[model samples]
Target chain A: MVAPDYLQVLVLAAVAIALIIVTIEVVARIVRPHAPNPNKYETYECGERTIGSTGVKIGVQYYLYALVFIIFDVEAVMLFPWAVSFKEFDGVLGLGTIIFAEVFMFVGILLIGLVYAWKRGVLEWQEM
Target chain B: MVDLMNWAGIYDTIEGFLSGLGLSFIIPLTLYAIAALILFGFVAALVLVTTYLERKILSDIQVRLGPMETGGRRFHGILQPVADGIKLLQKEDIMPKNRDKLPYYLAPLVVFVPVFVIMGLIPLGFIPLDIASLNKNLLVAADLDIGILAILALAVIPTLGAVMAGWSSRNKFTTLAMLRSVAQGISYEIPFVLAALAVVLAAGSMNLSEIVKAQSGLWFIFLMPIGFIVFFMAALAEIHRIPFDVDEAENELVSGVIVEYSGMRFAFFYLAAYAELFIAAALITILFLGGWAGPVLPGVMWFFIKCFVIIYVIIWMRGTLPRVRIDQMLAVGWKVMLPLALLNLLITSSILML
Candidate 1:
């Protein structure tokens, strides 16, 4: 559970970050010189006329990798609460095997997903 | 003895001071606002120092004098970062003609805001003050029960900025960089949190302060060395620093997601990187190096000393190590680091069980 005061702290910190960025920008706007050339704002290409829009379709591999990652990522979060409370339950219930086995099962299944990712070469960084 | 380490006692001191002159009409929120501003200044100062240090350190490595002209050659360019800040501010806030302007503008803010939130959750060691006759007051902004998780949840928000900056730029490099960075961040996060979870298991609580307190006997680094390494590496990756900085591969991506930004917008991303580096160092100090736990010196000084050592190591890595390829980073994170983290957890739980 989060302390309510933390919310106030969070708000204050967020506002401060915004203020600092803005303050710096405002200060720079006052003191710095700015000159814009027609070519200066052009998207940089290595000394060649920019060709083709950047909106071209990218490989599906990035999305697929992200999808696999999210599944495993959520599983990691789920393990945290259990990890923190494991000692308490072990002390109270004295059923160490039950809790241990259950978590092992969960993690073991996840590890299999990881292995599958490896075996299928999903984790590999290859050009599509 | 009363606990000066709590936030409530500190608040009472502020309230008493506010009411002392019969100006008690100020709301409690205003006090928090003041604390928040102080923390902001602290983070800003850290970013400034770290940036200068990185430059100087890198220069030293390459046998060059970094920032010798700024703030006078006598001071060896100590004021160079300030000058650079001013220079960055004065530069044009460039927007590409084909850009999605809103996300383009918002990305930096999104990236920048989370640094402060993460800082607030970290305990930098307690300091005593006369107002409440405080004994053991925590230096952190909030001692939330979900302490580290709260930071983790907030920490995840910055990646959205990377994604936004990447997609909105409409540049092939920025978009590609964004995808790689986001993927790297996401993949690395599992190991990062799991390594942290190993600490949680050992400490038996998720509160950052409690974890620090638990380390009073023996530092977790001595107890869980593997967790330390995994966390350190994952954190390095999470911040997109050197070795793990493939997402912003300068040669391949030309500054990657931030390629299109200029002026203050670029500065925001740059500042965020430094701020995260500090937070990562602070987190490591708290979890492994016995935060504020030492002989003779005050907790705050010990905390800073320990944190700086870690920061120095991080900087050394930046200066020395070559950047890993994007695929190699993901592979190590998921394949090597993740498994090691889980094994550490297993080993930790078993030790605690006995």
Candidate 2:
């Protein structure tokens, strides 16, 4: 299937920008009050005033979870569209089986990180 | 209907076919640039309309008029997003005190741009790719072997914005919110990937159109509901919609990572935030709900409808649910959703093998 022409995309984009800009303008006028306060801006937590800035120290372990996640989350995203075409070029291109093995092993290699996180007790709920 | 998708690789064919008609050097580059701009603009329009639809539906679900008063006519809230755009334009683009200026301004565009880039890869209903007089059966865009990688590449940029926005705010609550976004982004992204990988394994291809085509007779949901559910839920969290919008919990971390932004920058953050909601919904429609597949309607119409329904559900969720605690959010990902997604994938693979 051939794609749409550039002019069409421009028309579509113009519609998008116009729609977005207009909508935001209206919503702002509708929702945002004419005046606000310092108290309103101060971090609202529960009914009471905030204690200790809500920015207390965090553990290094959380960082570990994130590190492992960054490596895999992005990788998983790369895997989806490939999965979409798995069987199409099955014989001629060998796109299907190759993608599976590559990603399976990718996940396999990354599972080690999960195990490490487990060993480090990132998955555990108990407090030390 | 004029199709922007024709811009995908159409220029190459155009130049090829039209070379007989005229001489051209700068034509291809100009055409590509124009196409990209259209693509961005189209996605921006989609995000805005989706945002309006989200609010409207959510308001209806809760028994309220969403933006009816905006146009000052009943049901004319249709133009609410348009109006909002004009407001953002006129509003001051305020920079926070003690904030890094470069990435600070760039963050919203960084967050917003990639959503459209991903949109490109999804075959938006097979438009005929009328090349240099050869009729070939294929999609409208570049069918790269690594199409999915482009999506991932784009997906990675938004989190950078989230973290950057938090850090640049230089406020304590903003910092905590930023850290929470890191945790949220990381946690949800895992199950999402795992479940998506499961789908890839089952479908055996990485191309989204191929995935949709494979499900022609039977959508993957019947064979892989658990994976579908997990993927949908994790995607929700990844996009930070309700039930998983802990990153922006008002009762806890203020507006989370984006507490400091105001005026258009704030609007940018807000739009970027809702952009995720719209993106996740579209993804679900494309991936699981069967991209543009239905009996009566045109493919694009079906795709758009399915996408809208998912968007409706996400907005409905926002109105109904209470924010989960950060710890509980993590636990659900690891304990509940992750395990279920993992088991679903394993069972799916085993069944396929059998």
* lDDT of every predicted structure (CA atoms): 0.81, 0.66
Instruction: In candidate 1, list every pair of residues with a backbone clash.
Output: B4-B136, B4-B137, B5-B136, B5-B137, B5-B138
Off by over 4 Å in 2: A1-57, A67-116, A124-128, B1-23, B128-143
Any idea what lDDT model 2 has? 0.66
Q: Indicate the residue-level lDDT of B259 in model 2.
A: 70
Question: TM-score of chain A for each candidate?
Answer: 0.81, 0.54
- Candidate 2 is graded, for docking, as incorrect
TM-score of 2: 0.76
Q: Given candidate 1, what's the lDDT at residue B217? A: 89
Candidate 1 lDDT over B1-354, as tens digits, reads 113323346667766788887777654555667677777778878888988988888889888887898888788989988988878877876777778988987888888887777777788887744456454477777777888888877888889999999999888889888888888888888888888988988887899989998888889998989999999999998999899888898899898799988887888888888899998999999889988888888889999899888988998888899998887788888789989998998888888778
In terms of lDDT, the poorest run of 10 residues in model 2 chain A is A1-10
